[model samples]
Target: MAFASGSRADRPNIVLVVADDQGWGDVGYQGHPVLKTPHLDEAARSGLRFERFYAQAPVCSPTRATLLTGRHPNRMGVFTWGYPIRPQEITLAKLLREAGYATGHFGKWHLGSVYRASPVHPGRMGFERWVSSPNFFDNNPIFSDEGTAVPFQGESSVVTVQVALEWIRKQAEAGRPFFAMICFGSPHAPHQAAEEDRALYLDQPPALREFYGEITGIDRAFGMLRQALAELGIRENTILWYTSDNGALPKVGSTGGFRGNKGQIYEGGLLVPTFLEWPAKIRTPRVTRVRCCSADIFPTILEIVGIEPPANLPLDGISLVPVIEGKWERRPVPLGFWHYPAPGISTPSAKWMAELLAAQQKGEDLPPDGPSQRAGQLPDPPYPSDQFPGHAAWIEGDWKLHRIETAKGKIRWELYNLEEDPAESTDRAAEEPERLGAMQKRLEAWLRSVVQSLNGADYAGLGESPSLPESKSR
Candidate 1:
């Protein structure tokens, strides 16, 4: 793979903005009757809007891992929320930094410990600077500033944007291409919106009022970010991509009529609202129905910036350069999603940071061998390659095949033609036995490849990681 243009000057500034727990129907352009997202609506009208964008997994940490690595989370053992990204994997931030891009990460960094010594902290993961939280945070949150706990005032979303803008502005002044990952910690559980934002949604139930308000706050912060970009004169060449980490919350979130919610292997849990704006490249507004996933973001960005990925690393995502250029009508490969049966590590950002802040203030240092610091430790290898347990889905074009393993170890298969039934209300497995059989075989093969990777296949001798088969999808 040759570099896209061969000049660093040709690379555009990239900003990946992710929302926590936001759903497909949460934005105004997506037909949300209540949420007022004027800025997002405008971006959709003026840029490339994706009708079928998916998160690699139905949870936050896994999806975030895919966005950063372009590889399936399972390949690195990030099976659920709060799991740290394996240190052996190369991240987009690390690659971009190596390519002379100023990289910064702001807001939630649930992939690993935020402490300075943690092997998987943003600083060690290639972020030149970061003000990050270990998990979802609330207003007046305390964040880890390169391992030092610092309390920030005002709304969490506002604080995140402000911190990121400060760094972005400096990069603009220095005339350097920058990649900023702004992950907002709002609209998640225990939604706590700013007072003024909450007032706009008083008509809704109390809980929903806060949830809607949090979304509104995100909208305001996003508007501020866009305005800042224009003021800096970098808006035209900046590729501003926006999407959520996962599906909606169970009660207070909307799935846009899709079946299932967060943490499930259904349309509602996977599908997300996504769009990109880069006036220098995307001069005309376009809407693409072609299916895409968060994993594609890594390769697409690498292609756009003319950076070559590491040769030995296998990517579950393919570059979407053709789609962005309006030359692609369909995806070239199937998308695989698996929810391995593993309990999530509890990583409460506010509580942990508060404790750190208190400890620092008291002149006490916490031990380095704490659970947070040891998050990246690998489990014993030799995982069962024969038995693939959990809910897994394989999507090719409009057809989706689900391979589910019941607690009793029975395997059940269901097929859905998503184009005809986006809700997944009807099963087509019995009616289309041949198609089901073929998809099942492919899905199972992919699952085995994932298992192989989990058993240290992909790593070769990098660590104790397993190897993946050569025929595995990249």
Candidate 2:
């Protein structure tokens, strides 16, 4: 598609909203028995709902990285939750800002440090304004406003949306196109919900009341945001996309009957509830089961705004423009997911932000070498070029193949026809040898490519320090 450099009115405003640790079966539209997500349900009904949407990873930060860069997180060395996005990678926000759009980010910014001096801070990543937290936060949170800690009161989701809407309204009044990433830190662990929201689920267990209450708060906050858009008269042209960072939490969250939860690479872990509303482009409501992932977000937005992605940038995600326009029923490219065994880096939002706030109040500063700035520090390549540890999966059409690397160095492969077995309860590897072999070969090749990217082959002249392996790929 040609780059869209049309008038300001011709370009659609974009709002990407993400929920933290929200499960596939958490919303009312998805047949959740208890949770009431009236706002999200209406949005799903009125727009394009995705039946098989997925987070690129089964955790937080990696999936967020994929959403921002249109590449697998592993490609940029963001292997798990709490990992920071590589500063060398091109971000969607930076591209949009360069294309004459005002860009801002609110709420959880788990991809990297929110400190002003951090190389991977939101400002460095192209957002002009940011009220972000280093990790998930609950009510009455402290956020970094371009690196200065600012305390805010109220429910976390409500405060996040209100702040974003304030910036959005200004851009709308000025008649400039804007892109806002509103990420909500809700229903994660230590579930804390506003009392009123918690009251809605009185009949449920105490733990569930808190869990469901946070979702209810998110639902109400989402409603407030959507209502504001309509009230501002920018609802028609704005593309409002809603999805979760990962899958459901264990015990407290629901996955709509998929196998595993959260950390696993099963359907419950990767699959997420997703919907997009763009009234100007999608006049009619529809639902699509064509497979898509968080990585698709960056490319899809770029195609919509008519921005050409940087040449030679390897994107694991394909433009979903065709899917949005109702032109394509199937994804042309298969989605690949990997769970590298690297441990998650620690980034406690409440603790870190409090320290930042105290330091600022006392006219002091935290150490530059703190864990918050670890995202900018590249690690040495410890694994061999051919050694891909942990679990990986390849998805093509209705077939899914799993490549498991046991800790003892044993490798196992499992294949399942997801169409017939959503839970992956029965492995079809033994039943369908021919299909299994083809998928296995394709998956191995893809893993090698990811390893090459991880080793910094893609940053040839990008000025990034490449952690090149001693030997080339076998």
lDDT of 1 by residue, 1-474 (tens): 232666767678999999999989889998888888888889889999998999999999999999999989998899999888887778898888878788899999999888767878887777888889999899999998878899999988999999999989998998888999999998888989999999999899999889999998998999999999999999998999999999877888889999998999798998888999999889999999999999999999988887887666778899988998888899989999999889998988877898889999998745432554655555685777767789999999899999899767899988999989999989999999889888888888888888777666666655532222112000
Worst 10 residues of 1 by lDDT: 465-474
The sequence of per-residue lDDT tens digits that candidate 2 reaches over residues 137-159 is: 99999999878899999999999
Candidate 1 regions off by >4 Å?
A: 1-3, 368-372, 461-474
* lDDT over C-alpha atoms for residue 440 of model 2: 88
**Model 2: runs farther than 4 Å from truth?**
1-5, 368-382, 463-474
In model 2, which residue pairs have backbone atoms overlapping below 3 Å?
4-306
What TM-score, computed on C-alpha atoms, does each candidate reach? Answer: 0.95, 0.95
Clash-forming residue pairs, model 1: 455-466, 456-465, 456-466, 456-467, 457-466, 457-467, 458-466, 458-467
Model 2 lDDT, residue 458, Cα: 75
